[model samples]
Target: MGGGLPSDARTMVVYFDGNYVDANDAKVSVFDHGLLYGDGIFEGIRIYGGNVFRLDEHLARLELSARALMLAIPQSRAELAAAVCETCRRNNLQDGYIRLVVTRGVGDLGLAPWSCANPTTFIIASKISLYPQEFYDNGLSIVTVPTRRIAPDALPPTIKSLNYLNNILAKIEAKQAGALEAIMLNAQGHIAECTADNVFIVHQGEIITPASSSGALKGITRGTIFDVARDIGVPIREADLTRYDVWCSDECFLTGTGAEVIPVVKLDGRVIGSGKPGPITARVLAGFRQRVLVEGTRI
Candidate 1:
């Protein structure tokens, strides 16, 4: 456990292991398998209007990630959900972000996970830093990075694991390219997703995004957009996309827990759509905001 920190130095409450502790006191062992070998799972959740949006869906995804990694979470789904809500309440968080992490506890310096006896779990709830207002207003410009997404056979993108070096590398490329984000392709050079968000394009009033088989994460926000599109009678589908498709699309955007819905005005220096957020993008974004405010588990 973390020690020797000023009691009032922390402004947020963190659920460290099984105890509610100060933010400064939230620490995990250096020998944790999650740190040593990236043997862990995590989820990024959002709070809107004092409600934890899609809590059940996020917990379900976390469970799936644990199952995929063969990692056993110490807490049950119901218990974990309660912990998330409790953490938000303890921090007096009305609208913010929550990062829930479960790591294979402290173990010897080895890759084998069985050596770890207990699992380390924690929850952090704090204010979220959204994309700049200008980015939302003028839109984001992105480049296609050289870092291809990991093949599903090697590491399925569905699992939100702690091993994110793949994404970090692409993010670096984005920064170096003077863009806000980078779009990653699959092993076969098919459009996959962005460094952190799921990618989507609208062509001729139809919405299309890369299929899960194309190495895209099953993003909760992406799913929400699908639902919103259905409710609004906008056609949507999943398919293997390419740079050409993006270049020719009428509009482009990204979705994620953090990014939410942001339009892509440029890709690889080519302007997307009319070089701005499209009508459909605006409608879906509005619907998403409306849905989050009313359709979630109240904190």
Candidate 2:
């Protein structure tokens, strides 16, 4: 999905290394530790009606990841916020996607972070569509790939690190299997999450998802669903869920910054519920839509 962003986006201004520059000219060194060793972190945020949805939460999550990697950001959070808003404003965009990347700066071919003294930061605000419109209209068909999620102890899922070979492999498996997304399971066979989103299932009229301990990323959109469910009086909980639970559940859905809230109709050829977007799924999405425009940091 290209997202069908207008041509104007190609010429959009961007923030790169403490300076605003044309997207075409914004560049990073080939020796950057981020490119060489995947030593960095990032955040994907969305702007709705000039409202940077959950900007604070996204930054907080970015901070957590940076802290985990011991990567010191060049600018303060406030400065970063201003830069993000300015990038959007300069592009004359009312709604778009934002990518904030902080790398460990340029360093030789070595495995030491201390070798890189300066970190690189860049921001790009643009458009994105994770799936086709028809998919949203009908629903998505996903699969459970053989590729299991990395053990939490081995690599904390909480850190939004630059390395994504694990997720990329799972995505390849899903595409090969004719699926739009892949559901990853932990080493213990517990449902962890989708390749890029957090998953949830409705069981006996209650919403449930895998616990944080199951290697699920603490997604911002995933958290917003809790508020949406609560506002609509839909009970929700987190537990150690398995494939059997998802198959038997009444409904299923996934949440993420790019995916937002999307319904899941079929899993590995098995129809979920009635093979349609469930009522609760629709309501939750509607609730999410209501919050996006009104609750956020105005650009």
Candidate 3:
């Protein structure tokens, strides 16, 4: 693996611009609008036991994000899906993460979208682990950062664009404060979401999270948690959340494609209920794991 060749191929292959290529050769241009202007859309999908989990949903979201940004995808849905599966096959991944990106392609040095000729696309399949086992076993530590989410009117969170300086600033705050994750608020001081994940809290036996309107991205894992909660007979809903609510809630957790599901035991400085993963959180995680293996596009 010295020169980007893995002992096994499960993490060293890529699909770039309609061709399968070695990771070392798959490179984007310096002038690509995606790199220069953060003009792009992406999706992080997961594969479980050789099956691509919820590929259709991820593709749908990608399409929606592209439409919102007025970006043209170079490939059709079927073609993109095929490329994803092929990338996984080339990498020989049994279980891994897939990152699909569509960029505005190379453009002039100036800020003109029309200067770009075509869109750039790439698919990468690789291994991912966002947190250590101990964190998942015990719980994660997070803090509320000063950086608020980007206002919906300015740039909707639903677009899933590459412009993530807002969240990155919040992450920097969390890291500086010795926290594993950061919770961001909207302009109204209402909870939006974590820097890299969606937030969920259990209060009085009812599970709740911030509505997407509050500036949180509707994550695939977050939606699956709703399904998981329902299968386990737990009530769930979307509502406004606050720092006080997180501190007082019976339990809390974060969800993402990379993070899967992780329990939260503390926020800011207050210890959450019992300071450990709760019964409901455990059940929902288990249920979500079960669904990952059974529901997917078989690769």
**Cα lDDT computed for each candidate against the true fold:** 0.92, 0.92, 0.93
Candidate 3, after superposition: displacement of residue 69 in Å? Answer: 0.4
Per-residue lDDT tens digits for candidate 1, residues 1-299, read 74564544368789988899977778889999998888999999999989899999999999999999888999999999999999999988899899999999999997888899999999988866558889888889999999999999999999899999999999999999998799999989999899999999999999999988999999999999999999999999999999999988999989999999999889998998899889999999999999998877898
Ranking by lDDT: 3, 2, 1
Note the residue pairs that clash in candidate 3.
none
lDDT value, candidate 3, whole model: 0.93
Residue-level lDDT of model 2, residues 1-299, one tens digit each, is 53543575568788998888987778789999999989999999999999999998999899999999989998889999999999999888789899999999998888998999899999999899999988887999999999999998988999999988899999999999999899999999999999999999998889998877899999999999999999999999999998888888789999999999999998888889989999999999999999999988998
TM-score of each: 0.96, 0.97, 0.96
TM-score of 3: 0.96
* Candidate 3, 201-231: lDDT as tens digits: 9999999999889999989999999999889
TM-score of predicted model 2?
Answer: 0.97
